[model samples]
Target: MEKHSNVKSRRKHISPVFHLQTKKEEDQHITKEVIKSVRRTGQLNLSSRHIATVPEKLFSIYDAEDENTVDWDFGKPKKEEDAWWNINPLSHLDLSSNVLSEIPAQIGMFQDLLVLNVIFGIII
Candidate 1:
């Protein structure tokens, strides 16, 4: 009987640990490609990702270039389409069905944001 109780207790503890590890891995899987796509399309859908907090990288997607890299093409004129001003600003964000507890104040930085979907979620 003591061994049975011990086994149950261990199983319960292991279950939460495993769940936490899986959540951590899923959170880390939010890759640079996703961010780049969002930057280009001005839309981000992170629904049902089990994310408790918004990733910090999303906040700086517009200025992701390294400051140390110097553009040596001073002689060449910049193209209109390739200009930084041409990039699409973040206008839509879908964070529904996530485990988010509070919307970060940084979200307000997206001045061009037109659609923010937080349905089926709770925000404090």
Candidate 2:
């Protein structure tokens, strides 16, 4: 009998459903202090009536050295850090209207976030 080597090769793919379902929302205990550091030096924009959750698709919008000024009309939210914190600073953000009683502490997950502007409502 002669010895023989066997080899197999195939590309694998994962369902989008599984990928979308895994990014869990942050908990409610997030503190303002942890998120406050990024608020300094840069301006903020808070949107009125934010969608239920930040989309996973937005994770690809990173531009480390873009240095582009935020659009005031759009009231865009941005990251304060120059480095990637093993996460997309733009994703998983929350910008509710001024009508909101309080900002969910869960926003602390945006550890490197920068701006938070109010679009239509006030942040009372």
Give the best candidate by lDDT.
Answer: 1
Model 2 C-alpha lDDT per residue in residues 34-95, reported as the tens digit of each score: 33432232222334323334333233233332367545453334643432343334332435
lDDT of 1 by residue, 44-69 (tens): 88887766677666777777467897
TM-scores for candidates 1 onward, in order: 0.68, 0.26
Q: In lDDT terms, how accurate is model 1?
A: 0.73
The residue pairs found clashing in candidate 2 are 44-116, 44-117, 45-116, 45-117, 46-116, 46-117, 46-118, 98-121, 98-122, 98-123
Which segments of candidate 1 are over 4 A away from where they belong?
A: 1-30, 74-83
lDDT of 1 at 20: 23
Which window of 10 residues has the lowest lDDT sum in candidate 1? 15-24
Superposition TM-score, candidate 2 onto the true structure: 0.26
Tell me the alpha-carbon RMSD of every candidate.
5.8, 18.4
